[model samples]
Target: MRWTVLPLLVLVPLGYVIISAQQSRESGESKQLEAAARHLTFGYYPSSLQQRIYQVPIPYGAAHVGYLETNSWSTSVLYVQFTTTAGGLDTFLAKVGTSRAALRSGSSEISRSQAREASWTFSGPGPWSGTSMHKNGDKPDHAISVDLHDPDAPTVYVVSTVNFRYGFRDS
Candidate 1:
């Protein structure tokens, strides 16, 4: 009876601690849900966690980096913007499975409905290169819009979306 009581006491505390840890982990993943409008964060470079989640690379010497995330019942979006060197820009584009030639000059490839979800405006464009990089039924689709007003430092805008339906669905 004594031994049974000791194991029960220790097991109860261990189970409680495990449950609490699981809750904290889930809560941390959902902090963005608190925002009703937009979950936008800007920095010089994306966090490692974000890089992993979004699978978007921040080229070396990237500046003016911005990351916007939106999630709802059916879709999750990640929009990233940054300014990097021309070579870096090319490398970045290639890594995302596209190239400079694929982008159209003086155009913004991001669809109007998609931009609205990120609370972004792709209008008032200059020398821009834009295109849809990749689309898969089960994987995230990526669209890129580049600002080439300053050829030396191109500002890249990319929208990566995980769509669960046929049409546009946002958070």
Candidate 2:
């Protein structure tokens, strides 16, 4: 009887410790996500607007998450951006591909092969512009903004956005 009681005491505390650790881990992840979202400093995203958006699961090894949000329909959009030298984007893409995340459809075709892709015209040191739309089966369209070019020399900034949208338009 004494031995059984002692064992029960040990087991109960061990179980409680395990449960507490799990809860702590989940809490830590939530905090990390909040931190990641707060780190996006794009001028277009103000604190008020930033609060309106939330962070989504990020692919492993991706450098930074620029933006993330979802509409009432559950359609969502995410912007994943990286700043690296001309030779670096390919390496970034390769790492991202290894994570098996679905890169926004047309993004894979945009090569980082040149000092600047002929497809993109550098607008200035800020975000250069372009947009593309994709149709998702039975869902709303997805929009991808063109890679914004950095205005100055050694254009190392690039942004790739994946958007899922759904809504009725007034005819």
Candidate 3:
């Protein structure tokens, strides 16, 4: 009886230690993710994960890229900013289903509210062009603004919104 009881006591503590370690590891991972989700991330090279998740076509050779992502129960928003060469800019525009001609001179389709949400300053370094493309129903919208001060290397800002306003589904 003494031998059996000793083994039981040892096994109980061992099992508890194993389970506690696993729980601690999992908790640490979740905490890191939560902290990352709470802040904006910036990089020269765009994150492929974010690009795929958001369906953003940030062209190759982009510089000074930055992004912020926000989510809710019903909506997700991706804000992207980058600088790209002239050809890269054209490619980006085409991938988003628009052309350079779609951009109107001296105007931005990005709303003040959207810019505020992204913490972006749309009022430029000068000479801006922009476009707003509303895709098919249920698809996200793309509103872009470009500071064409140096046309060869333009600074671009984009706001892509998925889903919709809370409690405002088009059903």
Each candidate: RMSD to true structure? 6.0, 11.1, 6.0
lDDT of 3 by residue, 16-127 (tens): 9999999999999965764466334566443576676566889988988877778787778888888999999999999888989999989877899888876777676769
Off by over 4 Å in 2: 1-64, 85-129, 138-171
Could you tell me how far off, in angstroms, the CA of residue 70 lies in candidate 3 after the best superposition?
Answer: 0.6
Better of 1 and 3 by TM-score: 3
What digit string (tens of lDDT, one per residue) describes model 2 on residues 1-171? 999999999999999999999999999996566545523333333234432232222223334334433223444433334343433444433433321133342233333432132233334343433333333343223222224343221122233222334333321
**Backbone clashes in model 1, listed as residue pairs:** none
lDDT of 2 at 54: 23
User: For candidate 1, which ten residues in a row score worst on lDDT?
Assistant: 31-40
The lDDT-based order of candidates, best leading, equals 3, 1, 2
- On the 0 to 100 scale, the lDDT of residue 12 in model 3 is 99
Could you tell which candidate, 1 or 3, scores higher by lDDT? Answer: 3
Pick by TM-score: which candidate is best? 3
Q: Compose the digit string of candidate 1's lDDT tens values, residues 76-155.
A: 78888888999999898887777888998878889988777666776654677798855655557788888888989888
Residue 83 lDDT, candidate 3, scale 0-100: 91
Q: For every model shown, what is its TM-score relative to the native structure?
A: 0.70, 0.38, 0.72
Candidates' C-alpha lDDT: 0.78, 0.38, 0.81
